[model samples]
Target: MRPSVCLLASAMSSAKGMSPGPMALLPPIHLYRRLLRAHRKHLPPEMRLLGDEYVKAEFRAHRNVENPVHMIGFLTEWQLYAQKIEGDAWVGERLDPGKVEKMSDEQLAQLYELMKAIQKRGTEEGQDGS
Candidate 1:
């Protein structure tokens, strides 16, 4: 068996006699790692940076949490976020007029930064074509 699968099986067996916990449901560290990987693979540049930073901060803050309920809730939320990004349900990079109108000032600023980056790249490409 693969090492990870072996490890998971071991963890599951060990937790069999205990009350159900986040670890019993799924390994928290593994879930966190997968969430980060999903963010990197699926999010746009600016959103990726923001998402990664937020995930890192949340994981770090909750590193020592022992409450299974809180851990499960946290993991569930992050898992859904990762799935949405991977499924292309998140439209962070798309500047839909309705979405743009609802964005907060910080989100608008991030969008502006992304626009600037795109414009810079286009200008460079045009200059190269000359």
Candidate 2:
């Protein structure tokens, strides 16, 4: 096994209730695969297609990131999103107001674009009755 996976496994096995710390995070490839798997297993076909594409693009865009903090934050958020999907807890949930307030303008713009895409897809799906 890769060193990162081994570290994650050891940390998980050793730390029952507490966090396993930063080094225990899943590597980017592992996290990406997990997210794709979660979407495949849980999402409807159209949503899964959109989600997989988005995840792939985002991972590709971030692949050359040199800052560890930004990379860790990105992976951690994606991990949380995957867990939410796997647990069926993402449905009917709204973005938290506080979290929205914390977003930078660029992040907000990306979120707005995503919301528009989702609405567009929803409208298309409604028309298609699928």
* TM-scores, one per candidate: 0.51, 0.80
List, residue by residue over 21-119, the lDDT tens digit for candidate 1: 443334556767887888788766655666677678777777766665556556666666667777988765544688679778986886687677667
RMSD of each: 9.4, 4.4
Cα-based lDDT at residue 113, candidate 1: 78
For model 2, state the Cα shift of residue 29 in Å: 0.2
Candidate 1 collision pairs: none
lDDT of 1: 0.65
Query: What is the per-residue lDDT of model 2 for residues 1-130, given as tens digits with 9 covering 90 to 100?
Result: 2345435544553677886564456777788899999999999998999899899989888867666556667777888898899999999999989989989999899999988999999999899996
The segments of candidate 2 whose C-alpha lies over 4 angstroms from its true place after superposition are 1-23
